[model samples]
Target chain A: MKPTARWIPYFLVAPAFAIFTLAILGPIIATFGLSLTDWDGFSTPSFIGLENFVRAFNDKVYTSSYGHAAIYIVATLVLEVLVGLILAGLVSAKRNTTFYRVAFFTPVMLPLVVISVLWSFLLNPDLGILNRILDQVGLESWKHIWLGDQSTALLSISVISGWIFAGFYMAIFYAGFQRIPSTIIESARLDGASELQLLRQIKIPMIKNLTEVAVLLCVTGGIQVFDLVYVLTNGGPYDTTQVPTTYLVRVVFRDQQMGYGSALAVILTLVVVGFGLIYNKLRTKDDSVVEY
Target chain B: MFKGKRLIAGMAVGLLGLAVLTGCSKGDSADKVLRIATPSLGDSELPVWEAAKASYEAAHEGWTVEFIQQDDDLYSTVGLPTLLNGKNSPDAYFEWAGARLDQRVAEGFAADISTDIESSGLKDLFNDGAFAGYDSGGKLSMIPRARDVTNVLWYNVDMFAKNGVTPPKTWDELNTVCAKFKSLKINCFVQGNKDLWTVGNWGGHIISRVAGEALYAETLQKKKPMNGPEFIKGLTVLSDLAKNGYVNESVNSIADNEAASLFFQGKAAFHPIGSWLVGTQQDQAPDFKMDFINLPAITDGAGDQDSIMAVFTGYIVNAKSSKKTEVLDFFKELYSPENAKKIADSGTVLLVKSLAGGTLDPLTAKINALLDGAKVVVAPPDTGFELPVADALNAAQAEVIGGKSTPQAALDAAQEKVAALK
Candidate 1:
């Protein structure tokens, strides 16, 4: 390769590298440093070693938020990934695939803020049509003040978040379905293999990598959940729906405890990165790639 | 190959140009332009700010004053910190005068405006209580804009009269009034507890009334436990209302405006809110004549019955600014008799003595009367304690109202948190 050609690859990647360094890496380093201090956002930081981390582990609110996040992760993994795969299976089997794709993915196009606010109105116990419909259908006992009830608030938020992103996950799974060669499926069908059997036995195994990717995305996204909970419940009705990011906000901004907030943020990052790494390790441990 | 070399060189030049264009700097000349940030966007004081900006620029030649409006939630937490940390902080910034301003003052973010106020005769312009929140070791830290009292009971006169309910003067009377309204299948109090702070405001007032100001102060200062008899008594009032269904079933779902709208639409009877509600009612619920009253006394309570939850919102000069004199000039213009009158005319209650004599709106007048009658105006519990404790208190109050936790249990948790803070 010519010197210019060799440098061209570096040149093409330079802008992105600079941006990542300045915007992402710099903040991560700063946050890690800040986590060891006891500074409010305004004051000069006083190093307090791992006291912030110690306090976080001891703090009920912080630990409770992590518990909420765990619930959210399981919820998203099931609702967004599993349900999305099912929807993808249905759409991939359909004649009008484009229409099905658009219909399923429509919620993904709307802003999450809009979706959360809209869901808040829809789930309101008194005025919302959801409760009214339940009343009309003689399922009045099933009606709930979904966002206001401590037992249901976090799950309700998770379901809404899942509903919003399910379509995006559907799209990913659909693409994976499309990438699968039709010849094998045709042969399987000719051999009297049912649609459900094909999906369960052949398609799923072929798209295992995509399924893993979707699970990773859902888990990491769940760990960082903030906007939906913030807009809908604000971790209210006794902080049942509180997540790490919202708790971090309350600490850093509301409590003005930047050092502690940074510690929470760092822990959250670690949780996400840790989950990703563990999931990757588990997936790659088989040392066998399922060839299409 | 030669073309590729030229292309690489060209890309390098373009990247440098982009850097030059996007690099951070003091974009505005400090001498030529003054920036002021406020949490007033279409709020009652927006017009007052606009008018002040126009007037100040008109009075001074070659000096442009830029007014930046930030959302209240964003401004209090995100905007202020970002501005303070940035290379070019605003010359003047709006702030809620409490622990928030205290934190800023402690960090030396605010210029000590004591000398400026004293020399400019602005010291005598405001009432003594206006400086209470901003005072640190006998120095005024910020300029007080107005004294805003929370926990005022704003009722629709028609609804009250229609229900044959008079303004309550005692806790028993208030309950009776609520019962009357509830008999008619109407919500007695339109509470926007969804915000948590709205309900927290009521909790603060109730605790202040039951425990007395000194005990409440001691509790906040960690001398007394939050879960004591005083707090339980106060929280029970709210819990009782919730249990009796006097408050809306969806109390935790609706916002302040939605609750007030219910009151205006005749679905509810009372709105116990801040003094700012007068201005809100003037603008939004103009057709409804809001009859204002103080919160009824707790029967045989130790605290003063007339005491209310009041706070001051004001401006602070950024210590990092190079244009202190210019910012001070604009602040003087903002609080001038003419501009303050404009603010008061918008149905806002002012702390300025000069603007206090104006022909205020009847609702504002009634609110001011309540403020005048207040024997001990305490800050909200959220403002009294540090943020974590205050947040826990807010959550505990929500728990009480939501039936998620009993008053004793929730307040006990709060008291434990408060004790630990000390």
Candidate 2:
């Protein structure tokens, strides 16, 4: 290529690189620096030198927030990922599945704030439709304050998250199901394989790459969940639903403890990165084993 | 080709420089703007605010009045700070008078407005006691706007009459009334503890009565332990109400407005909230007959039974603002006699002594009477003390009210968290 032609590509990417540096990289670097100081967003920050990190480790609420996130991640894996795979299999087996596909994917199109607010009203104990329906059906014994009780608040949020994203995962897996060779599926059916057997043995194994991606997406997305939880629970019912982001917001915004909040943000970033790395490593090892 | 490359490079550099400049740029300062930050007002009072703005701008040529209104919850917590730290901070901002005001003053955001009040003749409108606690060694940092009795037991007048029960005046009587309402298949008391402050404010008053006002202040101000026996005793008052199922079962899940809806729909017999409820009811439930009474007296209580949980909320001139004179002029117009009357007619209890009487609604007049008779005025935990300590106490109250912990256990957990704050 000519020398000027070689410079064209670099010129085209420069603006985006500058934006990335200003918006993303700058904040990351600033957060790291702020993590080492005692600043309340107004006063001049004084060097505190890892005291914020020490306090975070000792902070019960901040540390327990991770435990809540773990529960949420596991729950989403089942409700969003596993459930989506099952839904995809069921929908793929049916003829003319457009209606089912559209109905399932509808929640994903709605904004998270709208979904959270909608579910908050539906779950309200006194005047909410959920409890009222239970009473009307003579199932009052099974009714609960779904979002208020500690035993149920986080799980309820996970269920709502599942409801919103299960369709997204299903659409992904359904596309994968469509990409499977029709001849191989027909041959399996001709050999007397049941639909379930085709899905479990043939279809799922053929879509291993898609499943890996879906699981990775679910795990990371669960870790960074904020808006839905903030609107629905605000980490309430005695911090039972306190995830890392909600707790970070409370510390930084509400309490104005910017230094400590930045430290918490850094810790959360490390955990997310660590999970991503471990997942990639395990996937790569599995791929090698299969090749051998 | 070389010329084209240089053009591309110049465009990229211009884009980067533009982004940097945009991020650093402040709002237009050449317009002679007087900006104010306040909590979003309801429909009844918003017109008055707009009128005040128009009046101010009309009186001063080339002057523009800008109001930054935020949701009530956000205004008190994150929103105000974010705005104040931004490049175009408001000239004046609303703040509750207590530790929050003191924090702003300490952070150098509040200007001493005493001289402005005197020179502007705003001092003649309010009583001397209205400026109490606003002065830090005679440096007045805030101008009083409204005095809010933060928590009062507002009962449905028709519901009480139908049930043949009078308003409760003592602890046992209150419990009896709740029991009677329960027997009638009515929710006795409905509160949205979802944000924790509803129960936190009410429970703070109960704590003040049981543990005494001084100890309540001492514990929440971080000078004493929160899990003391008297504090535990105070929490039990709230826990028993929860255990008895007097409050709505979804208290922790719903917002304050939702709980107010239950009360308005006659599904609940009583709602405990701030003085703002009167105006809210006027707008939201115009026909619902309601009256409020002070919290019931506790027998053998260490504190004065007549103590009321109240807070003074007003605006502080930003110390960094270049338009202090403009802000004062706007304030003078905002609090003029006609606007003050409009605010009063909307069921708000203004701190202006001249408009206190003869213009209030019947319910607001009763509230003023309560204020007049209050032996001591107590500030709620969240507005009166540090945020962390307030969070701890509020969470403890929520835990106790939600039946998640015994009062002792909850206060112990809270004390642990408060200790960690040090």
Candidate 3:
């Protein structure tokens, strides 16, 4: 390569590194220094060593909130990828699919805060239209406590989450399906094979990389779902709906426990990195089986 | 020498600003100017900022009164805590009792005003037992809102009379009335426990009924274990109400105001709420005829069957304030019978000595009279825990009502957290 061409790459990368250091690395470094101290954002920070972490580990609210985040991520991610892949296959099989595109891709565009506020009213016990529908169906007994009871609160929030984002996953899968040549699918279908036989034998083997990408996105997004949960639940009804992000805000801002809250943020980052490692390992094992 | 030089610099800048400050700082004040900061819970008396600026101007003819009001404005949204940590904060901020006050006192975020109170003549006026209820370092950290308010069980007089149900006096009687109302398909009690404090109110106030003022105060304010008989009895009363399905089903996120809407709609026959609701109702639900009744005593209660659990809001001037003397004088004027009457007339049962007649809401009057007659008044039992402990207990209430944990388990969990506050 010419000397100037090599320098072009460095010039191109400088802005990106500047942004990364200022935005991401700056906060991480500040938070690390904070985690080692006892600062309530006012008094001079004293070296407290690991006291904040000690308290966080024992704090029931923190533990309960992370548990909610785990359940929220696992349930939503699995459902989105599986349901999304199927819808994508159905759409991509048809020629020139504008209708399918519109039908499956609009809901994800709506803002999450708007969805949370809308659902709060929709699930209200007395004023809500949901119970009214139950009454109409002669299922008054099944009208059920919706947001109030501990049993249904987590699942209810998950359903709203799934309903909002499934469309985006479907669009992702549909794009991945389009990238594969039609001949592979046609060649398999012409062999007098059943639809399921075609799906399992050819389609699945062809789009494994796209499936990995979809799973990765779903895992990352599911793990970080905050705005909807924050507005709707605020980690209440006895912390059954508690999520880590909500608790972090309460500690750092409302309780003024900046050092302790920073410790929680660092731990949460490790959890997301752990999920990424598991996904990468599974993907590597799947990729080892190369087609001849 | 270095410290003296900086002090001289500070004096130079402070002197450079006397013209601006002579706005709120009166001539007679010892020296300092005062700034007041408050999270504005809407007051019709002053549309928050306008009222604050106007009143500060009126009272502080010479010195400046910087009124930093947090409305729905984003400035307050982001600035409240950061500004609190600045070299100086508001000389006085309007304060309401409970964690809002307790948390500040515990964090060493507030200035001690015991000396100012002793000198103000207002101390003797306030020389009642209110200050003795809860003390921090043997000093009254707050000058409390004038009257004691319990969560009153308010019912529609017309509805109770027509239904042939006398209001309930005991936990069993409450259950019976609730059952009768269920037969007629009416919600007997209204609450919103989804957010936790609603459940805290369930034990904090109703527990006062079951345990009586003395024992409830002993356990809640005195740091006595909740496992004892009085605390156990109080939890049992709340758990029974929850078990019977007597509580309004809409409570999770249906805020307190929404519950009031239920009574206005006549969907619920009674609401267990603070006495101040009468003030809120006159403006929010004028057509509804509301009446108050005490929580029926558990037999062999503290002093009288009529006593109610109550909390008070209070005010204090900054001891470090340069205008400390002026702020004290302004407060002394602010709490006079006439001005305090405005507070009472506006809504609260004024803490200043008894105000003129019409200013008192009938329900407010009765609760005040009831307190006057009582041999003992209980602070809600759970608040006696130190700051973090009280908060943890308040937070754990959600689990108790959800049946995720037993009352003692919940209280114990709260107690453990309280003990950990150190």
Candidate 4:
């Protein structure tokens, strides 16, 4: 590039960079610094180095919330990934692609907050039709309190969350499916391969990148699932549903222990970055398998 | 090349438009705005907020008054620290209890209200017990608002009458009454502990009974470790309520409002909630016949059942605001005979003397009378409670009731956490 053009990219990017630095980087720095002290967010933060980290590891709520998150990650990600792959396999062929694409991706259009609220209302006990239907079918004893039961509270949150995002992943897989050359799938089908055989043997291997993306998205979403859990459960039914973000929120906001909350946030950020990195490395290795 | 030039011009115009928009939002340079932070949206504080802002604006006429109702975190966390930063702060605000405000005063963030109290003749208006929290190097930094009554045991009068289940006069009698209520298919006592504060049942009486008033005072007053036999017994009594099915099973998963609604909606016989339940009843459950009595004698002790758990919410002035005198004047105006009368009329048994109890809605009046008769009042057993004792009580007990944890293990774990709070 010429001298004038050399400055063009910098000028073009400067505003976005400045905004990101202020909005994201500044707070992260402040929170990290604050995490080192024993501050109640008001006092002259007594420099209690590593105490917050020590305390965070010892906190039962932290472990419990993370454990719940671990369960959610496996369940939601696995279901979404499996369903997305199957749907992508069935719809990869060229036939009214727009309709199939639209049908597969419709749920992604609705906001997660709205989905959470609508589902919670649908699952309400006394007034909700969910229990009423069970009662109508002469299964009155099977009527459930849904969100109010400890056994069902976290499970319900996970299912509702999964239902909201599974379609989005399906679209991702379908996009990856379309990117695969038509000749390869046609050749496999011509060789008398079944649909499941094609999916298991041919299509999935071709769309490994898409599988990686779906898993990564699910992992991040699982780690940071706040609004739905907050609106639906508020981390109750005995805190069986509290994830790290919500638990950290309760600590920082409700308890006013900014130091402890920041420590938890830092741990959460590390977990998220770590998970992202491991998946990235795994994907890189997987991609290296099909260099051809 | 001409199209590219036009595109550059369009981008420049967009940038200028954003700059102008940002400049416009920079807002009036001289408008004095007070950001009044609060715990929740639905609180009695909102009315006081509206009335105070109106009074301030009416008095000042030129200045703009803003009520920035923050989320639950702001009051004790972001709001307090932001205000204490001394450059940007609220002019006047309200806070609850001593610990939060005491920290503020110690940090020199609270404006000394000694002169304001003297000049405005506010000293005479405040009662003796209200004087308890005004200490700070012999200058009052804050003024008490009103007493928040805790440790109320509300039993369904209708349920008791129909089933011959009389109100308990003693802990044993309370147990018997619970048995009777259970036999009649009543949930007995209703509370939702999913949040922890729901664990503050009527059984918290064992604290006063076993530990006695002086030891309870010693613990809170002296910052003693609360893992003693008395406290354990108190928690055991609370656990026993769970064991006997006195505490509703839905508690672990249910919320405060949900549990209270279940009670007033007649799902339970007794609900040990704060005195504010009277206000809730006045607003939501006017037809629900109920009676809120004090704790029964847990140990056949001398302490009357009339003793209650109470805290005084206070009005605090900001050290950072320039309109300190104006805000103080506005506070005096707001708390004057007219507005305090409005507060009393809103069903708050305020510290203001000689205010009529306003027909006292029969059940509320009975509770208020019993409260008036109390020889002493205590908190809901938990003091300087990190989360409001009432809220934590609900959450801790809900976990136990939900089968998430055993009551003893849960409370022990909760107590360990509570004991560790600085």
Candidate 5:
């Protein structure tokens, strides 16, 4: 390529960069700027530097909501990655992986709000099919007020969110599994390696990059989850299901505390982006040492 | 910080300049359309608006009426402000007549129609309390279309008869009724407390019943501390209801609309909700023999037994719009007894004192009588207070109900939080 052609590459990317500047970076910078001012959507924004952040640290609801987000992110990550990998491995082991893959991926295709609402009815303590089935199976004691009880509400919502996105991770892992050389797996099997041993030693190690991608997607998605929780619990039953987004919405729109909510948004972005950068840095260093 | 302010100011000026340029390019129309936005309830209100629009357009020449219907959530969160920003703003909009309207008025969105409403002899047409929310500093920003009684408990007659439980007249009697329903594996009162507003409404009724509307309002306005003895005791009644499982076990899981659905499905014997439920019940369960009753007075309580929690829900004109004359003409036609009759026929309870007398169904007539006997009406906490304070009160109520905090502790926490709100 000519030296001027390299300039053409930058020129070609300018529109995308401008769009990003206007759409993403602008809002993020505006939010950070607004975090220092007490604006209620209307009226002049009065600068209240560090007050919103200071209040956020002292505010029990704010702190607890972030804790809930952490819980939701961790729970969703474990369920999605672990279950997704298992389902991917099981489906790939079979000759007819197409049907299984399609079936697993169906939930991801459905709207998150619709699935959440559907799960709400299914998990309802009264007249829900879940409780009815439990009654018929003589496990009536196991029936719970799934989205109402403080102890179970966050976990139950996480389970639903994880269930919806599991298929996406599953598809990624299945593709990862497909990329594994058949000879390596065959040799492992010939060496008397069990299916579990083959999966742990060969398949998983070969899919490290795909696994990393899956983890990153799951973590970011889980951290920013709003619609399912909003549709189902709405940060209720004593705000037990409150994540940052739900509480931020309450602060911004409902409560009209725009500055405080902006602070929350900024903090959430930092947490998510910070985690991504750290993970990338560590992974990049490890890959450099691999000397492939 | 100064740079940031200047940048934002520059952006605002640029936007305003752009809007002015656009306005000049479009030019003004001789026959202007008076665009009115209303939230769609999928009920009789839409038809009423249509009828009003037609009637108004017929009377006024060289003018048009446009009804922009929005979903309730969008109307509040985005539509209201977007419509009010002096760019293609609707001449008028329907909004809940309370703190929401108050907020709009404070933000200079709601026009004060006090003189127009009164001089036109229209103010006399509505009930005194109909203007309670919109009236401030001798100005009426909005007029109510209907008086919503939100705290009354309605019982299914068939369920009550089958269970051999009569409507309770006191707190102890209510407990007995709940126990009877429990024995029959039926929920006593169906509640969707997850929304927090529902819990707040229930708490409002109990608080009004115990501490009276005067004290409740005072406490809410911060004229009196919310952590007072009366307030704590009133909240205890609500805590008892949740802790004792008088409400549905999954009360905190379901949405308010879903809880009402469960009530209509005969899953619960008693449903405590606003008068709006009557319209929904008529639509959803036409044959369900339901009768409305007041929340039983607490024994030795200071509040009047006849008093109920009632508030107005209605429309406000956009102060920023240039179509005030056209909007008033529409309101005049809309508030006429003829349209009021249509609204009443649609199963809504009207609070227009002049149009109060109507040929209504047996159930509605019964509810109207119950409303008439009310000595003093109280606003629901959610509608009465600012959103942040209301939200704080709701969270506190949830804590008390969920057994996470004692009633006193919750109230104390709420008092502190609300006091801190600007």
Candidate 6:
């Protein structure tokens, strides 16, 4: 090869590398540098060493925000991923499932802010339709302040997250199920396998890789949940629903504690990276690719 | 190989040229433009802003005035700061006249507009008290526009008349009225604490009344512990209201707009909020007749019984802007007596003394009267003090109201947070 050929690959990759450095890598490094200083986004940043990290450790609300995020992640794993798997299986089994598919995926098409605002109205204890319906059905005793109570606020947000994204996971699983050969299903039916048995034994097992991907997506996405919680509860009813992102935003913008907020951001980044690593380690290495 | 090196060097030179050109384009027309940043105004208020923009531009040949409007909550917190730090920062921006303005001044975002105000004849337009808190150690940093009574007990006039209840004058009378409303299956008061500031403002006033404004200031400014007996006593009032079901059960879930809707819909007897509710009521529920009273006096309280929770709001010229004279000129036209009357006619209570003479809407007049009657004026925690300290107290108030924590325990937690801030 000519000397120019060796530089061709570098030339081709230069733009992308430069963009990545400017956009993603630069901000990460800047945030880490910021984490070490006592800056308020305006004044000269005084080097505070690791004081912010120590403050984070001792900050009860900041530490509790991680706990809320953990709950949200666990809740979304079952609510989004598992529920999505069942929905995909059911939709795959039936003929002319277009209506169900569209209805399920409709929320995924709308913005999360719009969805959150809509659900906030629906869950409103006084004027919302949810409480009104309960009253109408003579279930007044069952009506509770869904987003106000500490016991229910975070879970309500998690369920709303599930509601918005379950369809997304379902679409992925449905696509995976469609790729399975019809002959295998035909043989199973001929062997007297019930529809439930076919779904539980064959279809679900076949979509294992898709389910794993969905679970991973849900876990990472759950850890960074912000807009939905922000619009709905705003980490309120006494910070019961405060996740790391919401807390980070409050500290950085509302409280104007840029250094502490940057520290929180760094900690959140580490957490998300740690979770990704753990998920990778625990995931089964089933190298057997399904043939078409 | 020589050709390849030439090609690489040419590309590098081209990229450098493009970067310089791009940078030049940003400032090409920047000198002739004046940008104003403010919270998104209502449709009725937009015309006033547009008129000001037109007037300012018409006065200066080859000049343009730009407005960057953002949502109110976002504007105060993240939006204005982001804009100030951006490539094309505003020449002037709207801000509350307390800790937030102090912050902007400290961060070098606010200009010393005292000379501009005096030279432009804008100083003589308003009452002497209008510019009360717009300065720091005699260096005026902002042009005062509106004197807002931030928290008032706004009640439906018709609801009060029909229910055979008069506006309460004391804490016991307030409780009796709430009890009467409760017996009739009505929420005596409705507040939305989702954003925390709604209750934060109201609770701040109550704290001022019970604990005295000095201690309230001390606690929120981190000079004293928040878990003091007076602070606990003040929070107990809020907790009792929530526990007795005087306020809506969904106070912590719903937004302030939703709570106002409930009051408008006659689902609640009273709504405690800022003076801006008059404009909101006019826009959202045009036919809803509402009147407000200062918070009822607390018996045996340490603070002035006639204290009012309020804040002045206005615009500050950007300290870093080269267009300070132009911004002041624009304000001269925007806040002229004639324009001030137009704003007052639009249901806003202006700080202009001339416009305060029997020109305001009845509800706004009542609010002005309440402000006039106040013996002590206490600023809300969120606007009057450091945000982290305000947030701690607000969260503690929410905890007590939500039945999540006792007033003592909640205040203890808040004290801990405040101490951590130091």
Q: Which candidate gets the maximum lDDT versus the true structure?
A: 2
Candidate maximizing TM-score: 6
- What is the C-alpha DockQ of each candidate? 0.46, 0.63, 0.26, 0.39, 0.60, 0.69
lDDT of 2 by residue, A1-292 (tens): 5644665687679889999999999999999999999887776789989999999999988889999999999999999999999999999988999999999999999999999999998988887799999999999998999999889999999999999999999999999999988988899999999989999988998888899999999989989999989999999878989999999999997777888899999999999999999988887535532210
Ranking of models by lDDT: 2, 6, 1, 5, 4, 3
Candidate 6's TM-score: 0.94
Tell me which of candidates 1 and 2 scores higher on lDDT.
2
Alpha-carbon TM-score of each model against the true structure: 0.90, 0.93, 0.78, 0.83, 0.90, 0.94
lDDT of each residue in B1-422, candidate 3, tens digit only? 66865786688689768856875564434534567665554575444335445565676676665666676332222354565666667777655455445655666656677787778666655535657543456666776655555566889887899999898777568778889998888888887655455566656666666666566555555357665666666676677676777777666656666677777778888888777677778888887887877776666544456666666556645444556566666566556665666666666655554463444666677877776666655555333333343456566555655556777787777677655543
Tens digit of per-residue lDDT, candidate 2, span B112-147? 887887888878878657788677556999988878
Cα lDDT tens digits, model 1, B210-246, are 8788887677667777888887888888899888888
Per-prediction CA RMSD (Å)? 4.0, 3.2, 7.6, 5.6, 5.5, 2.5
Please state the error at residue A275 of candidate 6 in Å: 1.4
Reference-based lDDT, each prediction: 0.80, 0.89, 0.68, 0.69, 0.80, 0.88
Tens-place lDDT digits, model 4, residues B322-398: 66666666666556666676666676655555444445456656655665566676655333444423234445445
Report how far off residue B415 is in candidate 4 (Å).
Answer: 5.3
TM-score, cand. 1: 0.90
lDDT of 5 at A110: 93
In CAPRI terms, model 4 is classed as acceptable
Worst 10-residue lDDT window for candidate 6 chain B reads B353-362
Off by over 4 Å in 5: A1-22, A285-292, B1-22, B26-31, B41-43, B118-133, B349-354
Top DockQ prediction, candidate number: 6
Q: Model 4: how many Å of interface RMSD?
A: 3.2
lDDT of 5 by residue, A95-173 (tens): 9678889988999999888898799889988878899999999998999998889899998988887788778888988
User: How does residue B59 of candidate 2 score in lDDT?
Assistant: 89
